[model samples]
Target: MQLSFLNLASNNLSGKVPDCWARWPYIVGVNLGNNHFTRILQTSMSSLPLLEMLNLRNNSFSGNLPSFLKNGSSLVSLDLGENQFSGMIPSWVGQSLSNLKILVLRSNKFSGPIPHQICNMSVLQILDLAHNELTGYVPKCVNHLSAMLVINNSLESYIYFPVSGGQLLVEPLLLKERVYDYSSNLGLITSIDFSNNELSGEIPTELTGLKRLHFLNLSNNHFIGQIPQNIGNMESLETMDFSRNHLTGTQIQSFEASSFVGNYDLYGPPLNNSCSSNSSSNKEEVHHVKGINWFFVSMAFGFIVGFWAVVGPLLYSSSWRYAYFQFIDRMWYKLQYRCYW
Candidate 1:
């Protein structure tokens, strides 16, 4: 048969996938999620050399990392989340699937430290291991995932592959009780979720280097120590959760300037609030005081000019002074004659 894509998700289908995968050499995408599919046969992947997307989530598939995936060098997005899979997250995923952009194994029973080898995927953008039994510190080599470092607003986030007649798209995923549209913003999103685990140790400072990461969740763990001091370097963060942990870090994760309210010692690019906001207010206050002083000065000058305009003539002009006194005397004489009559 000539097949390029097979999507049997959310069908309530049960039973193991047939061992006939080797029969389709042109297959590029296979999704068997949200079903009762039990297991991935060990040798079933030798045939689909062109497979790029494999989503086996929300199923009863249980076992160590599938051996067949080690040879899936062309795979780009692998989501085995919400499965019964257990065992150490294998290293071959990084050794072989070097082109992967999305890797999610959340809601599984997998245990053990995240393999440093997984950092080999330079283009990886989304990594979710939440709601698992995994333990161990996050590998410091995470900065090696180069795609999470810089924000590529152009053609990088549109990660899709053109198959024989159509396209294989990645759906959205949920992390920390929230889900994002899987495909539209896939390439533009850089996230990491390791919440609800047994992991401990200081968070690697290297994580601060991912200057464009959008979401981060490390809640419900045994972590201690302050957050990385250089975290100010990550400027593109949006949603961050570090609750329910042993973290003594100021737990400061805000983009608002008010987050630095009492820090008279803080200084840097974005922290220049005192210079921008306060200086503007101070200038306005000084301008208002200057206006009030000028008004009072002008009023006093007007009062002096008016008083002098009337009194100066009476004081300096002899004829005008004599006329003023003669008018007063005539008014007094008329009042006396009226009284006598």
Candidate 2:
């Protein structure tokens, strides 16, 4: 019994769980999801020295999460989503679950900011906490989980960054890295996805530091401000999505129209150049051209007027004087002939 694998998923099991299930020393996997067990998880279950995977989703367990799991050294994957758990996430989670690989706690009532200590888990691969009441800026250390897969249980619209030689996936950071496969474990790390949360503020420019990053998604959040110009410099990036936010500025030519949509403030190619800065640039160019035309016209008019004024007197005195004498002589001869006296 202590060395067996227990899988009781989708069962109608009700009432308090037996304590005997917790004392098992060699349990490798346990699935109690979609059950009606109303009692809090036994503390002794956390004491199980060899438990690797546990699924207790879709339950009515309330109050703060148990602290014993934080001390469970051998736990690899844990799924406690769809519960009524509340309070700030414990900071010791990353520090305590050093060997943990996959953790899911989505669709819960948990609130408050994510702990920065989450970056401490160097071996973590997948983390999902979507559809929760959590708020505040995404923890920056999340970028440190080099082998991490998905974040927040959103695999459909999220970007999957994988280690070198890893296969790309359509799920949110849902791609798999083959650390166990000697041929595929090339130690390359790429990908991050954080969409549809209450996260606000500017996108960190430092994220461009991930040179190996090929895909990124930060949509449906409250992020505002100009898209960092450096984002275009990521040569390895093949797909990027930053739609449905308050981002503003001219769209970078490096990214296509699909990269940014639903942002009312964003404008340029594929749409009208309605952005204020882009319009202002066009207006300045028009004004510059008008000023140059006015300058050249004024210079030409001044040259013509100045040249005539300087040479007019000489022309009238030399050329016009001879003509005037001839006209006078002709008029005197005509007068003599007509008078005849």
Candidate 3:
């Protein structure tokens, strides 16, 4: 009998994945999640080239990522979250799993900076690495995620693998702040979750370019600096979380106060703290007032000096004053005659 699907989830199955299952060449999806599966996966992996979806979440899988992941280049969705898996996320992930549209490694012991090579996943639409021990800056090259940047109208966008019974499912993803089941409308949903880690640095402004992205979570981390001012450009963003960080800025009108809580340094509307009215404005006002006072005093002094100079001269020389009046009267009459003509 040819087998194409297996669901051994929530069974408390112990020990490594069975070696016998490798002989099933037609198998496309495997679910061993919610089990006590432990120890290293054996060489049976090389036998399953057609495997597309693998879920080993909520397990005791330990040590480095399996090389079979590299072997399974045909994979479209992979979930290893909620595992005891340690060590850095392999660079080979980007190199081998280039076809991956959804990748989740949250709630693991994985550490170190995210590899820049991850930008190579041009079709990757959902990435969740929250609740890990990861450190270092969020890779700025993440702007290279083309799938999130452009709208995918293709009918083949949803993740599904053919099975004897039906297509095997990709489970609903639980992010740090939200749970998204992109099963029906996968192509229309794009999100990135890097919250609850040791990740530090300014949230990259480049992320605003993902105009089709619907959700983003960078909360519960050490990220510093103001939220990107152009974040409003992410028109598709329906959910976002930047809480429990050092983020400081004016509150964006698009998001509610809950989206930015735990950021003690941040001040704006939606939060109780108003933007501080600083002394700079007062100082400027004082300086302007002083300048205007000085200008008026200078103008008044000039008027008095000019009046005294001309009037004193006129008083001392009646002939000059009389000549000046005669000249003014002749010019006024000549101007009126020209206007009448």
TM-scores of the candidates are: 0.72, 0.60, 0.77
lDDT of each: 0.80, 0.66, 0.82
Query: What shift in Å separates residue 306 of candidate 2 from its native position after superposition?
Result: 75
Per-residue CA lDDT of model 1 for 226-276, tens digit only, reads 668888788887876666665542435354444333333333334554445
List model 3 lDDT by residue over 1-341, tens digit each: 67777788889689877678667887788888889989656577667888888888888999888876778888888899898888998898998899998898988899999988899998898899988999999899888998888666676656556663445466676754556676666656788999889999999999998887878998889999988889888878888888899877676766888888888767777777655542354467789999999999999999999999988877889898999899999999999999999
lDDT of 2 by residue, 229-323 (tens): 77765656655678788888866766677667878778888655677865586689889999999999999999999998866765768766677
TM-score of 1: 0.72
Ranking by lDDT: 3, 1, 2
Q: What are the RMSDs of all candidates, in order?
A: 19.9, 20.7, 21.7
Off by over 4 Å in 1: 164-168, 253-341
The candidate that achieves the highest lDDT relative to the unseen native structure: 3
Give the C-alpha miss distance for residue 173 in model 1, angstroms. 2.0
**Could you tally the backbone clashes for each prediction?**
3, 7, 0
Which one is best on TM-score? 3
How well does candidate 2 score on lDDT at residue 201?
79
- Model 3, poorest ten-residue lDDT window? 274-283
